[model samples]
Target: MNKSSGPDKNRMDVKKLVSIGIAFTLFFIAQGNILTVTDGGYSPSPKLCSTLKLVPILSLLCVVILVFVLIKMLKHKYVHFKNRELDSKTGSNGLSSMQKDNERKRPAGAKNKTIGMGTDVIKLFQQMKDDISEENTLTLGYRHLLDLACEHLDFSAGVIFIIDHNGCISLRGYSGIIPNSQENYTLELKGIVSELFERNMPRFIRDINSIPGNCQELFYGFKAAWLLPLMPQGFPVGLLIFFHKDVPKHREEYYPKLDFVNIAACWFYENHRNNRIVACENRKIEMLIKTSLAISSSLSLDDVCRILVSDIGKSFGCSYSYLLLSRGRQKEMYVQQCYSERKTPVFEPEEKIIDIENMTWLKEIIAFETPVLLGSEEIKGYPQKDKDILKISGSAGVLIAPLKHNKRLVGILVLVEQRSAERARMGKEVLDLCTALIAQASAAIENARLYSSLSDKVAQLTTMVNVGKALNSDLTLLSFFERVLDGISRNFKIQNCAILLRDFEKDELYVVSVIGHYQEDALNKRFKIGKEGITGRAAALKKTINVDDVSKDDMFIPSTGNTGSEMAIPVILNGEVVGVLDVESEDKYAFSKREEILLSSLMNQVAVAMEKIKLKQLDKERANKLSLTNTLVKKLSGTLDQSDLLANAV
Candidate 1:
């Protein structure tokens, strides 16, 4: 049995060995076959075949080594791949953790950046506030504010507009590259500006195309614009506008600064408003002071009027300024003094008279003692002549301020061709100022008139006193008449004056003394009472006669061809017309009221002196008759005897 087991184990070993040998053999055969195929089955010697058989074995060994090397490469590749995957997972986890950390820190970083930006904005505001605080004038303040805003906000252009109470807008200040059309931008409140003013809201326009077509022209060349209303005490006073030439990328960044911008705008508005008020008040005070000084400096009405017109033209920037004095019983206003800017046409003819009787507005102005503003639109209501005058003068508007004194209209102060917007802005203020000025001017004018009248009256009284003294110094009637005529001509500034004496016996009026024109021939010229000229008429009617234009009067007897005006005042004494004093001039209406009173007063003294002379002459004549009769009676007694004379008389 041991021998049989041993044999079986040996058989098993032999079979495993046989399997190995067979596999080896098969591999060699295959390799030989491959070699044969590769070598194209080329035969060689037996010795070469034997050497070639070792080639197959060597080839099999090389293939086995190559396979082993390939397996090792695959294992290395798989290990490398697995390690790479593990590394990828670890890297992904690290990245996630880093991302979470970053997310947590982001809010803090953002907060810090926001605080820094806010600080920068505050610093900018403080800088701007410091910059504009030094300005005192409204115009300068506006300029500074606009300039600073443009510089700080990267704006291309800016403008500030002030709206008056009358809904008129004026360009107050501007900065950078303003359009030429906007240089004199003045208009009534209208359009987008007006709408903004009415609504009192801020408007930010990112797209200019969004603007209305009608107002787009105002924002030409601008890509974005902001219009901020300047409201003080809830009243729209002005607008602050900024223009951007380019669209900003981060517009939100600027949104936070809008509040800062608004604060700056409010600062500008308050400062400008205060400055304007101060300036206006200062101007008013200065004007009042200057006017008062002028009024007090002179008693000459002409000088006062000149100062007033000059001041008005300078202060109000009027094209023409003038004063018109009321004249004649017709209440006509005559141009007294005038001042005009360069090349401005005269509004009214020099010394032209404007009748207030037909001008209801003028009458209202005088009656109410207020100013009347007349624009070209309202000028149609004026008289044709006045309308023509205003048109010729190129007046856009005329402000008429009445000069009233003691409840009477003394004169009018007219300012012509004021700018319409400026007029709307300052009309009431100017009117108030002018009203005060007119009050002072009226008083001055009235005082001057009184002074002139008093001076004339005093001179006339002096002349009459001198004449009376001379007449009472035993002067003859003819000498007295000549002296009276000379005094009338010299004192009354009359060129033609005559004294006509009544001849009661002849029932005629005879010129006793004549001063101007055919003086010698006029002397002692007689006219039938109640049938002849002005002197005769005066005597017949026992009243004074004044003809403004003798050419138009049928009763005027031309003493001279140049006599356009004449006055005949009757001298009455003891209830009867004694004589007439006649005066004439080449100028129509030359006899003023003062002259009439002077002549009347002079005639009164003359009449009294003449009456006394007539009485003295009558007494002398009676004495002469008595003496002649006595002498004749004595001569008759001497020649024949008292008895014979008595018998003849009986």
Candidate 2:
């Protein structure tokens, strides 16, 4: 019977005994060999034998020490190898488990089970992390992710559906054999996808017959089904659908793992969506920068408008876009520039100008300080004129961005989207993002408008200076008036212009000077004051009158039928109306207030010239009479005769 010693103690004892035996064997062999080689069987002396005995004992002791050292070294190596094996099997938790085992003895089977489950969970997480980390997984869609989940969970078929913020669900990926149909093209808000998302939980179905009719075909020949909602944010953005041919034996144990997969899938899906959103936002920002550049490219309002319409139309995917500018505090606006994706015009040339008073929708848009987005149903409630315009433009949805500056509404940007089953309606996010863009555009447009107005003022001043020079120069009264007409026709960019002088004694206005394509009879045309043409009205009222559309103005009597717009200003001298300056254009609304002011200033120069000519004629007549009187007196004195004097007097 051996006393119980630990493995190390027992091994040390065994090595000691073995080393003693080997030492004894080696000593005997050395002695026997020496005896055989010694003087042929000669008897040894007592001293020699004693020496031999002592040497053998010394040799045996040395051999036992060496062998014991070697055995100890080998034992240390074996212990180290066993420690490494234990560490490998138990991982970092080995020491802790040992402590726990000493504290309270538990069944080894339970401990092994716990460790195995933990290892499996770690491996599952690691595998999912590796799969999602791949770059292609994001771009190629999440089909691989679904496939991984199916493979791990032993599911036969699986599908994934992603939901947007608008409650719109779309099929992201599908694996395994699943029936397809037109109804499955896109999952609507009221379908199983929505139901699963709203439930926000994992559901396990034992029977396949319990599924909805439309979705039952998808899991045909399947015995069991499972649904998992991917709700990383407490609200579901995705759903996972899986079908099994046979019920899993470890279904209970698989739940937590399945939930983990759900979480991982959700994380991957959200990251993918977030990346796309960021990309989309980046594109929108780039568009805004480009639009700002376009607006800053020019100071001309027309050029700015043209660039804006095109950029906005293309960027926002609009079917038609119009840049409508207000008429300076008036409830009126006109399309400064328009764009059509279909290469068709939205409004005719004559219909470019719009009266906001008649269109309630325009007025509403002008009243708001921000952009407004309207759907087709909401647009139906707008005014008839607005509806007609939208219909003609083929607009199913409308986005109106108010362009405001200095706290005043300068204009509105109208973006029209056509109806299409494949296209998506504009979202509110568009309006939110566009708010800043609209604000920047408004400031730029305001600056452009100011630049345009200043240019017009400078031009008007130049025309006034030129007209004054032409009227004051050494030209006859008739030539001076002709020069006035010519200056006006050129400076104002009008095709038709005339000067009409009122006959004080006849109470009639007659054309004095004319330019442009006037009828042959226009030169002598006459109108009764206070009752006839635009000129007569200006003369009678002694004020300026502007008609945007001559065809709509009853007071407009045309000298040439080509005139579509007309402006008349009275020419006054010493507070009395003496004549009228009439300007006309072939395009409707062609005459603006600036033109009226310019023409009026030119007419003042005309009045001054008339007065100067009248005074000059009077002075000449006086000089001629005086000269005749002097001649008569000289003749009478030379004649020294009463008859001669009397004839001169007569």
User: Candidate 2, clashing residue pairs?
Assistant: none
Lowest lDDT sum, 10 consecutive residues, model 1, at 91-100
Q: Per-residue lDDT for 380 in model 2?
A: 64
- Per-candidate alpha-carbon RMSD to the true structure: 26.2, 15.7
The clash count for each model shown is 0, 0
**Compared with the true structure, what per-residue lDDT tens digits does model 2 show for residues 342-449?**
989788766877776776656667677888877655666666666775343335578888888887887788888875412534555566666767888787788788
TM-score of each: 0.54, 0.58
- TM-score of decoy 2: 0.58
Question: What is the lDDT for 538 in model 2?
Answer: 83
lDDT at 87, model 1: 34
Error of 1 at 364 (Å): 4.2
Measured by lDDT, the strongest candidate is 2
